[model samples]
Target: MPSAASSEAPSEASTAPWDVHRLPRADGKTFLVTGGNAGIGYFVAEQLAGTGATVVLGSRDADKADAAATSIRSRVPDARVRHIRLDLADLASLKASAEALRSDRLDAVVHNAGVKFDQPDRRETGDGHEAMFGINHLGHFALTHWLAPLLAAAPEGRVVTTGSFAATSERLDLDDLESTRDYRPDRTYGRSKLAQMLFGFELDRRLRTGGSTVRSVVTHPGGALDSLTPPRPPLHAPTTGERLRGLPAGILVQGKEAAAWPAVRAVLDPSVTGGQLWAPRIFGLRGPPGSGPSAVIWRTRRSRPACGRRAAT
Candidate 1:
């Protein structure tokens, strides 16, 4: 974990609110962001690359990763970025991607790739698990297992997981790990997100117990809409009524750039600690990054994070 004092300096260094543009130099550091082809992931990768970090864009599609890297280069003329083919739905691919990084130590790993919504019917991955649970939770679980050693090798290594508001509504049913019985798409996705929170906080507890400096932090981009993001492929064409209703909701919705703030803060901000959750400042729907405990993780009225055994679910 980075020194709390070091992270505090930047706050006093400037009067401007914390954002990606204000991050300190990252010249020699390295970061890997899953789902970096587009959305918040792409923007995060671009922001880090702009800060001189060697960013690796992990995506299932090599072409899309290349395009994202090219876009980053176009913006940061000298940005050093690379691509690694990663399919979080496949366990074998996750292992292979980890192996590809074996020779290099990583400063941070951003678990940003996940199925945003779900299909009408529940689907399973090659691992024979529910699609959302398999990709969002288990896949990242396995990836962290495989890469933890590499991350541990770095100074104050960090792991940042993308969580969701769904966690606030869903209950974690470890017994039904795959949601094999009467699975509802939305509920299953919620359960998966809750699992993500559990895993992240639990990992922090384990790391602390094991006397490791690595930190595990979770963040969410609340109510961010694709309509507010940059133009990209796989455009979500909202229906007329959807747009009509979204007009009022748009006040609460933000672009992907704003959505990426909390995750970026969790990953790079030295003051942030393990087991803490970050979200937007305004009702967690939109605004600058803010720190707090997840409602589901500890169910506390106070903002204090779960520490030690309390972090264990």
Candidate 2:
């Protein structure tokens, strides 16, 4: 396991307030962040841990989870954090995580784990679905479905799903949720992101329609600079000896930590609104959190413009 993640000791040069701590009420809250083992998920878990929140870092590897928890705890001496093993690629694991979490009412959940699309290859999941859509959308959908009861137990509990301006695609094929038909990395990703966004908005509508009020919000990492969308697979089929070509303008814009922020804030910040989006500034490079409309418009099955939050810095 990676040694307990080292705490990011605040630099004296940082613009954040010094000696002013803002910890959430952890007394009754139990939160979970999928893919909390590394990248932005780790730091988001870390910052939440700093507040002594009962944060659970959901990961596929138990060792990684332990390492992440240890590392996060090191940063916040009083952190009350732990781990839970979950693999988005497997439906059973998703069910297990949900079942385990059901034992403890989930005060909040962050559906932040995702995979970037690579050049076309036979990427399949246990349930026979394409890798990108399967892991990114279906698995998350199942997990959310499993945990809905737990979230609802908390009345005002929140569900924050990581979305992207990349979702601003112009079209979607509800008929082809698996991308069995025509596939392009950009449009595929955009479709998934669009699905997540619409899902977020639709979830809210469903809840309201059902007369149950749990806030379901979505966020966009405006540019690729911050969210740290993983790079594409090698262009070649075998991916051998090939340098793999580059990406479009905004594809690889943001850092993973920056991408994780919107989800983090969505869960921790009391101000987060259902169906609303948040992100960093720097044209998606990376920055502190701020609020605004998302650059991407949520379409039933397609999208329009891009949108997101700005940096407080």
Candidate 3:
């Protein structure tokens, strides 16, 4: 968290209406973005790299990660970035992955990696947990646990969790967190994101209780379309027809590049605080980043312990 005095200085400027184009410099910081090889994650990494910070792209695929890093270097000629292999679905690999991070003090970590399925069939991670819940929620939970020391070492370390608008309409079935009983693709995916959001809020509460400076924040990209996104070579290159088709959607939604704003602001903005939710400014769907709704109705206090227990098990 940036100090009140520092955030208020004219030079530091407040993020009342954060401008994605003019971000504050973070030359000495080292930030890691999970699943940063493509989609919204790649844009987040790209935008952050422009700030002169050393950005690490955490991806399960080495080839894609390398491509993303290379692409970033091409765009921001002086960008300092690298890639690390990280498979969120494999719980056993996270410890080694965290240890592999060379930075002694991690300024922030954007938990952006996730898996979404469209089929009705249920899928499980290598650890036998529901794929969505396991990778999106539990995996981040474990990763944060392992990286606690490094985060605490930073002046004001932060944890930014990428949630989804789908979570707003869903509820977590604590008993069937793995969705073994009733497995609907969209609903299951939504519940998993909701779980991740709750975990972020609860983690902040516990961190404050423990007198730790590391802050946890949650953000959601309301509606992002690939067609609306600009090309980035091997990662994403929408056809001209696709771009034309997405023109109408631009009024209600936005591109994956714009979707990355909320998370980028959460990581760079000094005014942002822990336990807060950030999202697109327009109807919580499109536009610049801003403070969004709180998840109080979800009763994170009561449900978070259950989520923690399940993850531990």
Give Cα distance to truth, residue 231, candidate 2, Å. Answer: 20
List the pairs of residues colliding in candidate 1.
1-213
TM-score of each: 0.84, 0.75, 0.90
Best-to-worst TM-score order: 3, 1, 2
Question: Which is better, 1 or 3, measured by TM-score?
Answer: 3
True lDDT of residue 127, candidate 1: 78
Off by over 4 Å in 1: 1-17, 232-248, 297-313
lDDT of 1 at 238: 50
Candidate closest to the true structure, highest TM-score: 3
lDDT string, candidate 1, 1-313, tens digits: 2111111111222223565568877888889999988888988888788778889888999888888888888878799999988988998878789877645688999999999555678788987988899999989999998888889988989999998877666665544667776588888888788778778888898999999999999888877776666544332245566546656766887878778888888877888889777877676778777775454433212222345333323
lDDT tens digits by residue: candidate 2, 1-313: 0112122221223223222135454555778888887766776676667665688888888887887777766667878787777888898777788876645478788887888867766478887888777888877888998888888888578888887767655446655676776677777777777777677777877887898768887765444332134422121122222212322434435444455665666777765667555566444334555555455544433222235433221
Which TM-score value belongs to model 3?
0.90
* Candidate 2, position 203, lDDT: 86
Global Cα lDDT for candidate 2: 0.65
Question: In candidate 1, how many Å is residue 213 off?
Answer: 0.9
Question: Which ten-residue region of model 2 has the weakest summed lDDT?
Answer: 1-10
RMSD of each: 7.2, 11.4, 6.3
* Residue 203, candidate 3: C-alpha displacement in angstroms: 0.7
